[model samples]
Target: MKELICISCPMGCHLQVEGESVENIVVSGNGCVRGIIYAKNEITAPKRMVCGTVKINGATQPVVSVKTKEPIPKEKIFDCLAELNNTTIEAPVSVGDVAIVNVCNTGVDVVVTKGLSKR
Candidate 1:
């Protein structure tokens, strides 16, 4: 058996996962449906949701926080971040504006977290 702390919810369930069969995997203290799914995946293949900054044009700040519209494969996160770091966008950026599209071929776009106004 392997122990895991569920990060999907604030409750952070203490769980035990083992074996390939779902019936053989013993889970305890999960707070919600999402936690169950999270724990199952975490045991098989852990993943993450990443958020970071990207350069913004004509804004008071040099950059803005951008995140994928949907979670991408964890392996591509660094490459996505690096790609975003290398790119810049014009100002008047909406809060949900797409800063980088099709990042790392994960079929996800990094979007602005907040509005960026023109100088």
Candidate 2:
């Protein structure tokens, strides 16, 4: 059995799950069906959004904020960050610009969350 707190909604339901596989798992203490789904996903294959800053050359600020375009496999996050750490973007980048393409081969782009202009 596994215990978890559902984060899929604002309710924050405490959930208890039993069974070895998703097919046979039983969930209790969920206020809504979303909690069941959240538990299953969290247990089977977890993912997370990556957000951080990378160095930028010639920008007003020395660094720019960036985030993964979509949630990536949790295990790939550090590898993704390592790639981002080695990256340096040119100034004049705009919001929504792609900072790193298919980062860490996860098929997700890292995009600029804040725009910066040349110094």
Candidate 3:
């Protein structure tokens, strides 16, 4: 059996999953559509959120916040981080700039969340 927490809302729904085809799912705490999506993804192909700091050249803090626009394959999370950690970018970054493209080959890109200018 597999367990997953629904991040759809404040009421985190706990889902219990079983079976090979993932049809024998038993969920009791789902509160809405978002929860259903979470459960389905959890049983079949679980994904992970990527959010961390990327080094920023000439910055006061030397790092800028970044996150994947979409959930990436959980299995490739480590690989994604490996690439991200190895990357370095200059400041003057826009909020929607693609910080890391083709992350883990999961067709998801990590991007900067806030603009960072050289100071």
Candidate 4:
């Protein structure tokens, strides 16, 4: 059995999961149905949203905030960050502009979260 805290909502239900796979697991201590799904996904292919800042040339700010357009595989978080760390973009970037396409081959783009104007 594995103990986990459900992050599906603000409730943060403590969960106890048993079994090796989603097909045969038993989950307890979830406060809502979303917790069940969260547990299942968490035990299987966990994913997370990646966010950080990247260097920007000619921008009023030296860096721009960025995030994954979608949740990426948890295992790829560091790889994604590495790619973003090495990335430098031009200024005049707007919020929602793609900074890196298919980042880490996860089929998720890294988008600008904060707009930056040319200096």
Predicted candidate 4 versus true structure: per-residue lDDT over 27-109, tens digit per residue: 99998888888888899988889999999999988889999999899999999999999999999999999999999999999
Q: After superposition, how far is residue 6 of candidate 4 from its true place, in Å?
A: 1.5
| lDDT values, one for every candidate | 0.79, 0.92, 0.80, 0.92
Order of models, best lDDT first: 4, 2, 3, 1
Among residues 3 or more apart in sequence or in different chains, the pairs in candidate 1 whose N, CA or C atoms overlap within 3 Å are: none
Candidate 4, residue 84: Cα displacement in angstroms equals 0.5
The parts of candidate 2 lying over 4 Å away from their true place are 9-11
> What TM-scores do the predictions have?
0.88, 0.86, 0.84, 0.90
Tens digit per residue, CA lDDT, model 1, 26-47: 6666667776787677766667
Q: Pick the candidate with the highest TM-score.
A: 4
Which scores better on lDDT, 1 or 3?
A: 3
Cα-based RMSD of candidate 3? 2.1
- Candidate 2 backbone collisions, by pair: none
Off by over 4 Å in 4: none
Quality of model 1 by C-alpha lDDT: 0.79
Q: What stretches of model 3 exceed 4 Å from their correct place?
A: 1-3, 16-26
